[model samples]
Target: MTYTAPITEQTFVLETVAGIGEIQQLPAYESATPDLVQAILVEAGKLASGVFAPLNRKGDTEGAKWNDGAVTLPAGFADAYRQYVEGGWGSLGADPVYGGQGMPFVLASAVQEQLTSANMAFSLCMMLTQGAIEALGAHASEDQKQEYLTKLISGEWTGTMNLTEPQAGSDVGALRSRAEPHADGSYRITGQKIFITWGEHDVADNIIHLVLARLPDAPGGTKGISLFIVPKILPDGSRNDLRCVSIEHKLGIHASPTCTMSYGDEGNCIGYLVGAENAGMRAMFTMMNHARINVGMQGVSVAERAYQHALAFSKERVQVKRIIEHPDVRRMLMTMKSTTEAIRALGYLNAAAVDRAHGESDTEAKREWQALADLLTPVTKGYATDMGVEMSSLAVQVFGGMGFIEETGAAQHLRDSRIAPIYEGTNGIQALDLVNRKLPQGRWKPLFADIRETIRALPGDGDLGAIKPYLDDGLAALENATVWLVGNHGDGFDDAAAGATPYLRMFGIVAGGWLLAKQALAASERLAAGEGDPAFLKAKIVTARFFAEQIVPQGTALLGPITRGGALLFALDEAQFAA
Candidate 1:
């Protein structure tokens, strides 16, 4: 099935659930008028469907090619990237001083969803580049910004983050890469980094690498680590002492090269430091936080694509009649539909929080919004990604035997989505961050109060009313789980950690239901006033009701496991597992 952008659904979620109107009221985003946002989305959808979607299958089949030390993308990828650059898609939400369009992040997020849904592998290059732009914009020196920001924002060059090594996967402090002070105030970097996405490619003029390495007199662990800018091509136009030793042959996203990068193989790799000495983690988090949210969007993106694919197939494929007419198939489709919408709502809502946190001028409001964003970040990343995997698997199940085959393309969605929960910090880590870190910050009180207010404000006598009871139950369960986890977090860290995963899942379901309930209210009001498309608005109400009835209860059901503690989890001795 050909990919089609769900513009109507996205716009509805943006305007109704995410409060784009309120976002635009901020000084930083006042220029993001509704007409301009619509124009941008329309053009982005065209680029996604017309240019990128066609390459999805070929990218999977052909994959990226690696020669002696160079990486080449699948056919037509370079051209697609060129179109992306030429159209200025990468400049949205970037700093205006650096030649960016300076659009709101929420609007840019909506555009990214369409792009990622069209071709996930192909969209990864842009994602990494944007992350680099953010890191440099926030941490790099004035000279560094002048040199790199414009080109990176304009898509003339691409960027990467190098954090992993053979022995130091999640334990970044264990890395052995070295950076020694040079004669000209620069540093000489020497290390072998792995799992570098789009680390080396022929699509752009140069690849800017943001690498983490330890200095000569630096202390042991992450504190001593410093961030460096190691470019494939130096300022003097000489080839830097770095090369792509090899690229990994992955399970999916085959078109995007995952390279094992070798720096200073000849012992002369040039490097420039970013930010203060021994403050790499702080700088890296700026990029990482940006990436974490985008990864959550990736979950929404792949799930939406999978749903569209499955829904299209169900309508076309017939056994006795159209598979969509079958009760079982219809259930699967509704599960996919309602779940996708819920996550999309959560993801977009999180994006709005980011915008408010950055753009809000009021000190107290900004702090609150930042706290809310931090709280939602982990839940959005963890729950949406786990659901991304489940939804894609269900999409494959809709095709039955044909899904297991390579030609049908359903299996690839599952394979591609599998990495989201692993990268950008694993979902387990996200869960722990949610319960162990965010919960202790005391931010959940205001957030919970807001959810309760929404529940109270929901009318009682229509479709919106149907959502109130289920949403209230889910919120109550979340509150109970939050109180239990917070109590255990101080003295029983293990117990809190043990239940963190389910706690995050429960939180996501409740948050998603709340956002959808808001959307349902908006849709109902529009229907009553005879505004907008009746059919679309009606579908919105139905999808929201379906989620409240079918999915919200799952949040309530998770409360037991969340409060069960860690005794059972640690009951078995490590060495006795085989027994």
Candidate 2:
């Protein structure tokens, strides 16, 4: 119930570890000067703390209601959404030519973390809309853009991504959704799509759904899928045949409607193609790649929210003279805080990489920036979401009996965080992507070089005197793992696959340590110069030390699992598990 945007910490990460200043130098982001960015963060913080934070508990309690194929969001949600639009928050990172502020994605990401921390369920609509904007901007035809982009950007309408069905969850190639060509050049769509977030809601006049279905003569796999723009309101202002057949009673994100949409129930539902035929997966993935980072931010958000909740609770709920004074509770709080900050920096770093990729004009620089961004994406999503769950659970522990109850709201954060790792390509899939897709993308060497350089840049004999060795060990472990994985990639494919999850976790741990160390070095420099806020700077050093000591060591321990083949995991027969 208590939350304040960590604007100062976020700003620190952006300017320091994430290279925001360099990003600002880019021509495309010249408009986002330091003062303007600070002002935006200040205003965004006010809205997040004032408008959205108050509604979070209420939304979770009241939730979105489904009746007669329509969803009614809890009271004040529509008003908050309107304010969100009027304030131009929704269009910050969208293209300027299309009714947006055209801010850099890194800056937008900072604001997004604040929103998600304040009210995650409410933020989901905005996140999905951002994805829709990206997909439409990238692939939608000019006519489609003219018809939909501005309205969606302005928040007069919203969007949904429909990819899942009863039979097809992760296996998109198995989908049975069919799209038949119409005389008017549109396609008649018929299928049931489930777990569509913000799929059906009344906050906006229309919902533009980016759907995936197959043509009758298309191939029999993911290769044949085609993307469609199916709207709730037809171009003629008539109602489309698509309807929300039902809304899932979910474990969390209670206020965000997850609909099971039935398209063309009467065989009159029309859809416009987004990209070329048999290219639906590519288009959908464009939106998905955008969503994955935001989803990772969601993890950071909930963890942040939970940490604040626990810190407040620990300070107030006195046991043996303030629970935070207890060693074990202190340890838990430090773990939560340090991990959250580390991942926050990682997320910002990822965002900054993405920004550089977009804004950089040089061909080679752009490719390198994009590679860094791609490399961090899976780690950011997988590790941060996993940390979110861990931090949220730690919050419950801090609250003791109170956290278990819904009234305390700690449990809600855990429940909400649980879905993040499962969705946006489950963490397991993220690991596989890290090893199979990202590692082979040929960025690991440069990425590892960057990591080592960061560690090497730290003051070896200064205020962080004792922590340097652990960070070194962590970096060494990561390098060894990377070498093993890459060396054995072809011949030891099964071993690499089995160790993929831990390997990614180790990647995050080392990356996080490097950033935290960078932050610590900055803090120490400020302290030595007798500049900036001494108390905050000192705390940064301590947090970094805590991470170095407590967290970095885990990276080395994962080597055992990394080299172990999947034989043990797969040795038993499917039916033998019950025995």
Candidate 3:
């Protein structure tokens, strides 16, 4: 709000709700003390607030220029890119063995909030590059990792996930990119990949494209798919056979290039295998654990941006006064604040769970925490992005006429945040995964119990007394919906198809409310010691309270539809209207 990056709110969540302090005991994470994290964040905030953020409007207005084969990015993007890499922010959470800082994922995630909030389109290159680095780290040969991981991690080069093809979008099974075996144990890839981010760029030395292709005699569909390290440069280190045929010219994030890549046009796109044959899906997914969370943060980041602008407009624009403070405008303002705060808490909570899972050394604790992360990742991505759109809309309402003007940046927030729900497996897909994959997957009941116990361990206090009851109710609703799903999941999933989105919404409220409660406890501790900022701590309590009392009720209300609403989902009477 007040057109500022919610850094104070963010730190409160990390230190209080997410418990960044507790993370220090974790091995490899000992360096990320609260003080160090604060120092990193303070530096990160300056870049976010000053360098990247000032360009949001410019990027949107100027966009990226595509002429012939080269795409010229917005002004200062190159400088920001250089600074980001030099700062080692790219490899903060990566293995120290590869020249990374080896900070906890929690800190990296927190810092990323500022990055994307500043400018998501510009940051997409960094986000995809990290995903490629991760895939190489997990599945690439030692030689491959040595050659690629350092620069990619250092952000000297960017990366892309080349999954979507002409025929395949959400359906991975429809991919037809081919990888042929060569004499030198490498593979030659020939394919046309569409919707490739940073497919070719001058911001970095090389563009690493993790192209998915099918090997000869490989099984059909997704199983046949293999991941390849198709660099724009040759193994002997010359330019290769990939071309950015064209860049997409629509929608938000215009500063980022979305290319159609033509691989092996000259039979020269030598693609090296990262993992074993046909294990491409496994290798691709290695990056997903964090990639999903990063996309979710985009949702959080843009929401904060939109909310900040909206809140500022509401406070300053004096159209009418004192309907005891213009109750109508006040309602719009309050809704914007509450929705953004609720979803922000959810995203931070998801980040905290990820930190716990990645940072914790104890095997059992790790598994349990990982389960919580699994549960919340989809919710954070789905609900938070949707909230961003809502919050952006409210920003427009507050600004009235000016919000409609593109110059105000209010309209752009809505456009940019809209994609969060669509991408990262779509919100609907995320919902289905929650109900069908997570809840009923073999003997994983312990997963739910693990989360519940950890949540309970972080108890509320007298001030938090009002928050607990609804949180408890929300948790119960989650339990009931989970049980109902396990019992009634239909064969091939057609009967239960329609409730996916609502289920994800239910999950977000419970998961977000839980994280806020955890933060509330930590804030109370900090308040007692007088170590935290009072305004932030107070906002933390209020936001958490608002979510539990006002928003968490959705979890319970959703149970009615989950239990008895499936038939209506498919009752469209196909013959009713012949257009």
Candidate 4:
């Protein structure tokens, strides 16, 4: 099945539900007019479907090749990258002052979804560079920006984040990378970084590495860690004393190199400090947060691809009749469709929150939006990724025995999606962040209140019928869970932590339902007015109804685990696992 960019669907979400109109009204995003937005979406969709989608299967088959200390991407990867750069797709959401188009990230999110769906392995390189651009623009010195930003934004060069070491997976403080200061305002970075995505490749002129290392006099742990710009080529046109010693053989996304990098083996590798010493964790997080959301988009991206593939397969595959005629197959397809749309909606909503947080003039409004963004980030990352895995698995189930074979391409999606939940912070960590970091901010009252009011404002049975009650009940369950988590945080934290994963899932269920309900409402109003495509609008209504009926109920069940699951979780002894 050909990968078609869901431009119409994405546009509906953007304009109807994600508040792109309000985003346009904001002076910061004045360039994002309706026409411009449409053009960008259309062009991006073309690039995704025409160019990137074609390489996906081949990339998976050929993968990236490692020869000596260098890595070569799959055939056509370099040319496609050249096209991506020439088209200025890399600079879409970057800062304009440094040669970026300065598009809103919401639009970027949509484009990224298309790209990832079309060709996940190929697009990983671009996504990492985008994260690097964000980090550098936000934290790098003016001189550093002048040196690196334009090239990075223009895609003449690429970038990587090197925080993970052999000893340090999620524990940044445990990293053993070192940075020794030099007299000429630079540092000699010596470290072994592992699992560095797009860490080494032939596509770009230079690869700028944002590495985390401890200075000699640095105190300890994460507080002593510092971020440095370690480029493959020095500014003076010399090779840095760094090499990609090896690239990992991964389960999926084989076209993208995941390298084990060694720095300063020959001598001291020159590196430029990014921010204040010991603030490496802070600065890296700037990139990580950016990467996390993009990872969520990755989940949405792969899900979309898998869903399309499965939908096509079902219609053509006959089992007594077309599999599409099978009720179970229809249910599976509905689940995949509704879940993908829900995740897409949540991703866009997060992007819009990001725009509001960035563009709003009022401090309080900005803070509120920022809080909302922060809250949703974990849910989006964790829930969407978890769903991506499930959706892909369902896609395989739809294909039955054929899905187990590589030739059908269903398994590739499953493989590609598995890494998302593991990297950019595990989904477990995301859940912890949701419960311990995000919810602790005390921002839930207003958000929860808004969810309730939105539910209340929904039209009655005439318009929504059974959908209204399902959504209402979901909100009620979510509200109860929120109250339980918040009220019990003081005395019930242990249980809360144990239940964090399900709580996050519940939150996603409600949030996705709420957003889908908003879309359904929009479609309902448009249908009543007799102004839009009746088929599309009718489908939207049906999808939303299915989500409310089938998915929303899961939120209610999570409340028990959220309030009472911790003791049982901890009941098992550390040694009991061996039994």
Best by TM-score: 1
Compared with the true structure, all predictions reach lDDT values of: 0.92, 0.91, 0.78, 0.90
Encode model 3's per-residue lDDT on 288-402: one tens digit a residue. 6568878888877887787677766666677555321677766676666666666776666677777788777789888877887787777777888777777777778777888
Q: Write the per-residue lDDT of candidate 2 for residues 1-579, one digit (tens) a residue.
A: 968999889888988887888988999999999999999999999999999999998988888999999899988999999999899998899888889888989889999999999999999999999999999999999899989998999988899899998899988899999999998899999999999999999888999999999999999989999999999998899999999988888889898888999999999999999979999999999899889999999989999999999999999988859898999999999999999999999999998899999999999999999999999999999999999999999999999999999988989999888889998789999999999888877897887787777767776575577677888888788888888888778988888889999999999998898898889989888888998889999999999999999999998789888877788999999999999
lDDT assessment of candidate 2: 0.91
Residue 322 deviation, candidate 2, in Å? 0.9
Task: Please report how far candidate 3 places residue 228 from its true position, in Å.
Answer: 0.2
The alpha-carbon deviation from the true structure for residue 41 of candidate 2, after best TM-score superposition, in angstroms, is 0.7
Given candidate 1, what's the lDDT at residue 107?
88
Locate the minimum summed-lDDT window of 10 residues in model 3: 442-451
Model 3, global lDDT:
0.78
Task: Say which prediction, candidate 2 or candidate 3, comes out ahead on lDDT.
Answer: 2
For model 3, the superposed segments whose C-alpha errors exceed 4 Å read: 1-3, 322-324, 442-463, 490-492, 528-531, 577-579
lDDT tens per residue, model 4, 95-115: 899999878999999998999
Q: Over 4 Å off in model 2, which ranges?
A: none
